[model samples]
Target: MSKRKTDEVTGVETTGHSWDGIEELNNPLPRWWLWTLYLCIFWGILYTIAYPAWPMISGATQGVLGWSTRANVAAEITAHEAANAELVTQLVAADMPTLPQDADLNRYAIARGGAVFRANCSQCHGSGAAGAKGYPNLLDDDWLWGGDIDAIMTTVRHGIRNTLDDDARYSAMPAFGDMLEPAEIDAVVEHVVSLSSSDFDAALAEQGAVVFADNCASCHGEAGLGNREMGAPNLADAIWLYGGDRATLHTTVEQARFGVMPPWGPRLKEADIRAVSAYVHSLGGGE
Candidate 1:
């Protein structure tokens, strides 16, 4: 047996292990610290027994309480729906045209409608209702269909140029490229250009006026003022769906524009439809 050694500085006994001349202290941990560690292990075991702890083949261990976060969330949703039942009923029964007449109901409708617009209409019309190139701007006075509350409701319900609804707004502009000779088409283009501004060859515009009277005037008025009944856009105004430039105008005259809007009546509830219509009408450009 080797001789036992003591530390010179603290006078503690050696652990009987050494590297070179250095020795490890035989002093144990503090009693309070050891007890604290034991208490933590005990608490952890208790917690495991009381709560969801061990994983099983199919699921996790369910404690005696039978608590589930998913079930709690489902119950909360059911409760919330029950709370709004009355408002939903009123919204469904309310007259759409006269909806704005009732101040309280109108405010509630607009609030709900804003949510509806964000979810559905925002994809095309944008969140702020500022539409893109093909889409009509909701914030503008120009409307292909009527902009009144009744008209807006109808358009939203049935949609535009879509097969989903029989009463959907439909109009077809003939591809003049197929119908008119290249030179005739050119003359017509000049006339269409002159409708909004004086930036055109006067001789070509005069020739196009004759072509306009024969073909276009049947739907569009002689002055190019749009006929809302036929879903025709006013060519005289500066507002353009695709563009207003000569090149864009040439393309429009050569090939017609056909845009489709799917009917929302089958997908959205009546209340949601009316609410969104009200929201749009409230955007300050409604006639």
Candidate 2:
């Protein structure tokens, strides 16, 4: 081994390893820093022994303490279920129409129904229930069926145009593509447009009036007002389901618009159906 040399100016010892022009100084590491490094190693060893740290071929090693995030979540969920058991039981058996009579139940139902609506109904009706082209707006007074609480509940439970459910609300607008000529269809479209507004050819509307009286009056009434009992929408109103534009009206008249709402009764709990109904009814449009 080579003997260590002292630097003249600084009086520091050389590390005895140097290049042709430079010598390295042998400096001692700070005590605090060395202690901190040792403490980190000790802590790492403790952590490995106390918690899950090692990985195996198939799974991780279980530490001394029996802790699992999945188990904790399950326990919390169980506790929450237990807490809501009584309310859920009451909601399950409660009369749908008289739900609001019990203030507490109604309040809880609305809150819970909001969550259920977001998860289930929001996809079609929208999160705010404003509705899209095919879907009916729940926030508006116009309803294909009645807008009463019981009516909403009935609709939610049985659904509309759901062929699978025996009690589903059913109706069909006959497709006039095969029955009517192009001129006759055009005349009828003009007549339907005139009933709502004068945004059509007067001569065509006059010709179409005869067609409307003969073909549409049976269900849509002589005055063009809708028949709720038959599920015929009020055409005279500004609000429309599939829209009342010329193109949309033509498509509706020719092909006939038949939208389907899946029955929630088969999918959700009884409590959930009631809850959603109540939530919808509270949206300022329920009669």
Candidate 3:
């Protein structure tokens, strides 16, 4: 319990408490360390005064810089737009056919179009335009309307199954549920399925033959070869729009499912529509 002097030069004292005969020093904190601690406190106070630091029930204080995350993002976008002025100009002026000549411009438009498509079309068409059961795959060559660049552009410019747009692509498939009885629809379904393969229920197809002639033959043709002028799909080709499954067939018969593709022309810039059309047309089935 004896006190001791540790530093003779400064006469620093040691704590009277000891363990194993080793005492604890009672030296003051180093001047440099104390100054650094004070500096941190001052910096914090200054930072609070200069920036939005205080928290209230409503919101934090508006910093002197008057900065916001949204403002920062807008500024960045503005800067980017300014930097790409020339490219944007080119995109606006260039036609779809000539776009491939300017690789940089084409690439920029494609990137922009891809972002737009992801935001808008990805929900139904899928991320890669693979499409859902009812939706037609853009990547495939099975187009209900047409797969040419001009055709795609026309489709995109005028949405299908949409009555809202005056120029919307409109076509009506006979609702077997309303037009014919369940038994008759079943017969037609069996007949339609049979077209894909050699196996077919002859009895059901015989019954369906009358129904097909009366209701379907007008657009689908007597042989079910399809009428391109009416955009009626070739039933014999095995490219089912809704699906080839029995359930999908039943649903199609029960209720005529109309797949609608939104027109991008009114919503998106011309350049973007052209780029997306080109990209979609290049997906292997483009005529």
C-alpha lDDT values of all predictions? 0.87, 0.88, 0.78
Q: Global CA lDDT of candidate 2, please?
A: 0.88
Error in Å for residue 28 of model 1: 23
- Candidate 2: clashing pairs of residues: none
True-vs-predicted CA distance for residue 238, candidate 2, Å? 1.6
* lDDT winner: 2
Error of 2 at 103 (Å): 2.2
- Give the clashing residue pairs of candidate 1, or none: none
Candidate 2 lDDT over residue span 1-287, tens digit each: 67689988779999988899588889889999999999999999988888787999998877788667778999997897689889889988888778889999889999989989999999999999999999989998887789998899989999999887998888889888888887988999998998888678999988988988878888889878888788888888868898888888988888998899999999988878988999999999888
Residue 65 displacement in candidate 1 (angstroms): 11
Number of clashes found in candidate 1:
0
TM-score (C-alpha, index-matched) for candidate 3: 0.71
Please write out the lDDT profile of model 3 over residues 103-211, one tens digit for every residue.
Answer: 8887887777677678777888899988877777788777777888777877888878786578777777867788788898888888877777678788988888887
lDDT ranking of the models: 2, 1, 3
Q: Compose the digit string of candidate 1's lDDT tens values, residues 1-287.
A: 95567889989988888889789888989999999999999999888877788999999988767777888999996896588777768878887778878888889889888998999999999999989999889999999888998899899999999988999989988888888887787787788889999788999899999988888888888999889999889999988989988788778888988989989999998878988889999998788
User: Can you give the TM-score per candidate against the true fold?
Assistant: 0.73, 0.73, 0.71
Q: Which stretches of candidate 2 lie over 4 Å from their true place?
A: 1-77
